[model samples]
Target: MDCEKQTTEYKSLLKIRTGDKGFKDLSVTCVALANAQGGRIFIGYDDKKKAPLPEQHVTPDEVNEAVTKLRSLCFNVGLVASEICTDDTGSQYFIVSVSPSMHSVATTSDGRIYIRVADKCEPVRSEDLQRLGEEKGAYQWELVRTKYLLDGVALDALRQLANDIRKSSRVRQHVKQMDDVELAENYHLVDEGYLTNLGVLWLGTAKQRSSICYPATVQYIVYDVLERKVRKEEWHDNRLNPKELLLDIEQKAVELTYSYEFPNGLFRKQIRHYHPKLVRELLVNALAHKSYTISSDIMIKVFSDRLEISNPGGLPLGITKDNILHAKHRRNPNMIELLSALEMMEGEGSGYDLIYELNAMEAKNPPMIESSYNEVTVIQNAEIIDTELLPLLDFVLQNYQLTQKAFTAFGIIAREKKVFSTRLSAILQLQEEDRLRSYTDKLLKDNIIGRNGAKKGTQFFVNPQLIKNAKVNLKTTLKTVEPYVLRTLIMEDLRAHPKSKISEIGGRLPEIDLQELRKMIYSMVDVELITEGARTDRRYALK
Candidate 1:
C-alpha cells in the first residue's frame, strides 16, 4: 500500500519518519502513546511526507529483535507491544500497535520516562510520574509504616464525621459495630498492615500528614470581577485535619460569594445571590479525587462572576470531561468513601452528575471540567435567576408536567413575549391550576418567588426583591439607550460646569428623552457615579 493511503488510515494515531534508524525512537513513542491511549507509529515516511522514502528492507529477524527489546524494557512496568504488519514495498515500513496497559507503565530501570504530548517525546516530570502512580493504585504513601501512635488517631474530627454518618441511613446501616480501625480498613485507609496516604490525610497529625507526599493541602484565592487577585490563601497545612480543613474551606467559599437581600414589607429575606451548591460540589469533588502523591494542594479561586476549583492531578483513568457525568471512576476512592460517610457526598460516583443536574434545574451554566498535565479544574459561573420570572416558572412547574417542549415555551414566555404555536400547545398541556399552585409552592420553598391574592383574582409577578437585587435588568425589562448620546451629554456637561445638578443635567440635553434619561441615571447609579439627594436636587460627581 502507498504511504499516503497508510497515513490516511491512521491520521491521529500515526507519526511518520523518513529513515530506518528512526524506528528505535518510534518504538518508545508508540509505547508512550499507547500508555496514554492506544495509537500506532509508522516508520519509513517523513512526518510531512515531503522527504524521499528510504530504499532499504528491514528483515523479519531485525523486526523481532526490536520488538523483543521494547517488550523487555517495559516488562517490569507492565506494558506490552505488538507488531501488526510490515509492508512489502522496496521502501519498507512497519506498524506497531500499542494498547492501553492494564497498569500505568514507567521506565523499568527508573532513569527517565517519556511520553508523547503533542508531537514531541517529553520527559515525564517526577510530579507527573508520582501522580500516575497514585492514579494506578501504587502510591508510595499508601505503603508507609507508622512507628508510633499519635493521640489516639485524633478522634475529634473523626467523631464529628461519624456523627454525620450516623444521620445518614445509607451509611449508618453499613457502619454498625464498626470500630475506627475497622472503618479505616473498610475505607482502604490502611492496606495490608500499612497505613495508606488517605489515613494520613484524614486522621494523622499535621506532622504525620506532612510526611506523606501532599496530603490534604488546599489553596484558596478570591478575586474581584476583573480577577485582580484580591486574596491569596492556603489551607490544611500543618495545623488542621481533613474534616476541619474541608469545612473551613467551604465556609470561606460561602464568605467570598456575593449575596443580596429582598425586602418584604416588614421583613428582609437574604439569598446567597450566587450558585452556592455548584461551587461547594466542585470544591468537594476536587478534594475527593485529588492525587495525594503530587506535592501541590487543591486550589479554589473565587472571582466576581465565577468560582474555580482545581486539584493536583488530571482526570482519573476512564474519566474524561466528555464522559464525566456518565463515567464512574475515582482516583481517590478511599477519600471519596470517607466523605460519603460524612454525608458530604451522595456516594463515590454521583457528585458530578448531581452538579450538572442541579445547575440545569436552576437554569445556570453547567460546571466546566478541565484537565491539564498536573491538574483538573472545575469552574462554576454565578448567575442569579430573574426574580419576576421565578413566579412564572413556579406556576408552570407546579401545575404542569415538564417536557422539553414545555420547558422551551416557558423559557420563551419568561424571556421573550411570544411563544411558537407548537411550544404554546405543549405548555398548555401542563398548565393545570393545581399543578401551577404546586409549582408556585416549590418556588416559594426555594425562595425564588412569592405570591399574593386569592383564587381567580390572584395575580403573579416577579418577586419585588428579586427584581431589585439583580445587578442587571431582566431581558424583558432592558431598554436600549443610545450610548453616544449619553456619553456626549455627560462629557459636555462635565466640561462646561465641572459638576451639575440632576435637573440642570436633564435640561442641558433636552434631546435626551425622559425615559432614556431615567435609564441612564439608573445605569450610572449602579456604578456609583450620580448621587440622588433628599430633595429635588440630585448631583452628578466623579467617584
Candidate 2:
C-alpha cells in the first residue's frame, strides 16, 4: 500500500461495530476523502508497523457489513467500491475505494461535511468551502459578478485593452472584430450591464480593487552577492490592470536583466541571464493562478546569480510541484482565458511547460518550483551552463518539431553530456520509463542523440556530430569530461557531509546514478582521496 497522502488513508479497522457509533469513524474518513480528491482506504493495516495484521482474516463478515451500510452513512458521494484481499503472508485486509464527490461537498448522514487534507480527514470549516468548491468545479471565483456595472470600471483601461486586443496577432481575427462591449462579454469580463470579478481585475480602478481587496501588486527587488538589497520597485496601483502590470514588470525586468554573449562562427550569440519569455510566462502564471481571495502581492527578487518569484496560494488544489508539469488545474478560469488569448502561454494550460522549454533552450538547469500551503516560489538560475547549446537547439527547432517536454529532455542531455537511464526518470519527475522515452526516443531515432550501454547502465548524450555541425569548439571530448567533473562534485559533497551514504550523496545530486556514484566514490578511495566505512554501515568520507 502507498503511504497516506491527499488521496490515500489507512486504518486499523473496517468498522467500529460496538454500541451506537456504528461505522461512523470509517464513514467519516470515506466522506472526507471523497470530498477532496477520490482516494483509497486500506483497513486492517498497521501503518506504523508497515505490515498487515493477520487477525483481520477472522472478520470477513465485518468488511461486507460495512460496505452494505456505506451509502446510508455517506452522503453526496458515489457508491464506494470495496474488496477483501489476501496478502502474501495469508493476511486479509479490507479496502474501500471512494471517488471524488460529484457535488462540491461530501457529507455524512449527520449532515456534517469533511475533507481530506494531506493525510488527515478534517471537518470542513465554513471559509474552506469556497476553496474546496472551486477545486471540485462547483464554483469559479473569477466569474462571480461584482456589484459594479460595466460603466463603473475604468473607461481608460477598457479603451487601452480594446486597442491592444484589436492589434493582437494572437487573438482570432474574427473574434477581434467584435467591439469593446462584445469583446468584454466574450472574454468573461462582463455580464448583463455588470463587471465580473475578472472584469474588476482587468478593467477596474484602484478604488474598485480596494473594495474587493483584490491585490494587484508586485515587488521587484535586486540583491547583491551578500544578499543586501541594492534596488527596489513596487507596483500596488490597482489602477494598473493585469495587462498594464505585466507590461510594467516586463519593462523593468528587461532594463535590469543581465545578458551574456558568446562567440560563434563569425558572429556573436547573445542570451539573457534570464529569458524574457520565461519572466513573462512566470508572471502571467502567477497572476492567472494566484488566489485572488488572499490579499498578497507577488514578490520577485533578483539575486546576483538568479531570480526568485513567489505568488500567493501555493498551487491550485490537486496540483503539486512533483506533478506541476503534467497536471492541469486552473484556479482562475476567467484570468486564464484572458492570458491565453493574450498569447502568454504556449498553449492552454502550458505556462509551466513553456518555462521548462525556455529553460532548456538556454541549456540551464531545470528551473526549481516549490510550493508551501500559502505560497509558490519559482527560482531560475541566471548562469548559462553551456554556451555551445544555443545554435544547436536552433538547429533542432528548424529541423524538427518537438513537444515542450521533449525539448526539455534534449536540453538536459545536452547540458549533462551523458546521463544514465536510471537517473533520467527521477530528474525528469517522470515515474514511468515509457513516459520518459516518449520525450527522448525521437531524439535517439533521429540520430539527434546517441545511446550507449543498455538498461540500468544505459547512457544518453547529445549526438557529437550535431555539436560539430553547430561549430562547437571542443577542447576535450564532451562524454569523457563529465565523470571528472562529477568526481570533483562528489568530493566536495563528502567533504561537507564527512561520513555520508550513497543515498545522501545522490540526494544532493539527483542526476547521478547510485551505482555509478558508488563506483566514483570507490575510485576516489583507491586514490586515498576518500575513506570508506564498514560493510554494514557503508559510507564514504574525505580522507
The number of the candidate with the highest lDDT is 2
Q: What is the C-alpha lDDT of each candidate?
A: 0.56, 0.76
Candidate 2, residue 16: how far the Cα is off, in Å: 8.0
Which residue pairs in model 2 clash with each other?
none
Query: Tens digits of per-residue lDDT for model 1 on 1-543?
Result: 333321121221222223334434555565555445344555434456522255544456655655565565453333333443334344555555555443666443334466545445567776567655655566644445564342465455455555565676667576756766566667666655455666666666777777766677778888876779877777755677666777787676654566666654498745564556655567677777776667787888878777778888667654556557555776666666677777676575767655654544444545676765567888877664555454444455655465433343334344423222333233333333454443345444544444333553333334445445543344533212235557656666756765567667678776454544655665775364656464456666644
Q: In model 1, which range of ten residues has the least summed lDDT? A: 5-14
- How close is every model to the real structure, measured as TM-score? 0.58, 0.75
lDDT of 2 by residue, 179-271 (tens): 888888888888887888888888887888778746667898988899999888899767678877888888887434678888866988778
Q: Give the poorly placed runs of model 2, Cα more than 4 Å off.
A: 1-103, 115-121, 213-215, 228-230, 254-256, 260-270, 385-405, 420-423, 426-432, 452-458, 467-512, 516-543
Residue 339 displacement in candidate 2 (angstroms): 2.0
After superposition of all CA atoms, the RMSD between model 1 and the true structure is 16.7
